[model samples]
Target: MVTPRLIVFTDRRQAARPLDEVVNRAIDGGARVFVLREDDLPAAERAELAARLGAMVAGAGGRLVLEEGPELRKCHGLADLVGAAEDGVDLATLSPIYPTRSKPGYGPPLGLAGLGRMALAVSIPVYALGGVDSPARVRDCLDQGAAGVAVMGAVMRADDPARFVKELLTA
Candidate 1:
């Protein structure tokens, strides 16, 4: 039932540098957790990548939540969150707290109120997602009762991923 306060998700398509490099720098910048979202890779490739990142982070006392991996299940809405808890997931991600470029038309965008309600409605930990890039937004999510925050595109596209990690950690 332990979860880190920040979880950085990977999106290779938007990466400004190699994922390992970005993740390594993030780790160096104090990011202690990550979610491996490169699901497009074949099972073997994904497993290899996971093992590599897992080892790297493990040495730093960090960890990775693989997409659909046994460790964590990401939930996009309240119902999904409830179901995940019922199915034994300890934590999940709830999204679109603001408009995001990553999912252009995917949502009408739930604000902080939605995040609060969802967190209150579920027993398991919930991480706020979507448009949560800056320190202020990260603070806003925590204020609304999010257990932590999860981010992808912003860090993935950042020219200085380490600095990005440091900025978010300041929240």
Candidate 2:
């Protein structure tokens, strides 16, 4: 199957403008999937943010995925979210699959082989996250059965987020 498109992990708070504006810009910038990962905000606030952001993204013909947090608690994050793509959420992002941006003090990196095993247990496409600094590694992730790779600092903090995404998507 053809890859849907680049999935951007957007930090609504990181942008100077409102969350809706940031999301609109991201969609305009060719971001097909957005993971609403504002961990600092409360659950209710996150839900509200997701609703607004979701509307803006859908208006732009893009998609939004709400991450409940790193632990996938209380119906927050889950692989099942992919099934709700039309209803608002789109695809789950299982992070720290290898030492990720969220939890640095966590256990050892869940190497690709181990990650593949874990991903096999789930039904939806899994995006390998954490420590992804090279686009070539995308092949390894896909080989290990990952749907895709999600990067934080590797893309957002890059000198060129667009170019970084191009390389990652092409990889």
Note the clash tally of each candidate: 0, 0
- Candidates in order: C-alpha RMSD to true structure: 1.3, 5.8
lDDT of 2: 0.61
Q: Name the regions of candidate 2 deviating beyond 4 angstroms.
A: 1-6, 12-29, 42-56, 69-90
Clashing pairs in 2: none
| RMSD of model 1 against the true structure | 1.3
* Tens-place lDDT digits, model 1, residues 1-171: 467888999888889899998889888878888899999999899899999999998888988877777667766788888998788777888887888988666567789999999888988888998999899999999999999999999988888988989999888
lDDT of 1 at 38: 92
List, residue by residue over 38-71, the lDDT tens digit for candidate 2.
8788979977888888887788776676665432
- The TM-score between candidate 2 and the true structure equals 0.66
* lDDT scores of the candidates, listed in order: 0.86, 0.61
Model 2, 152: alpha-carbon shift in Å? Answer: 2.5
Best by lDDT: 1
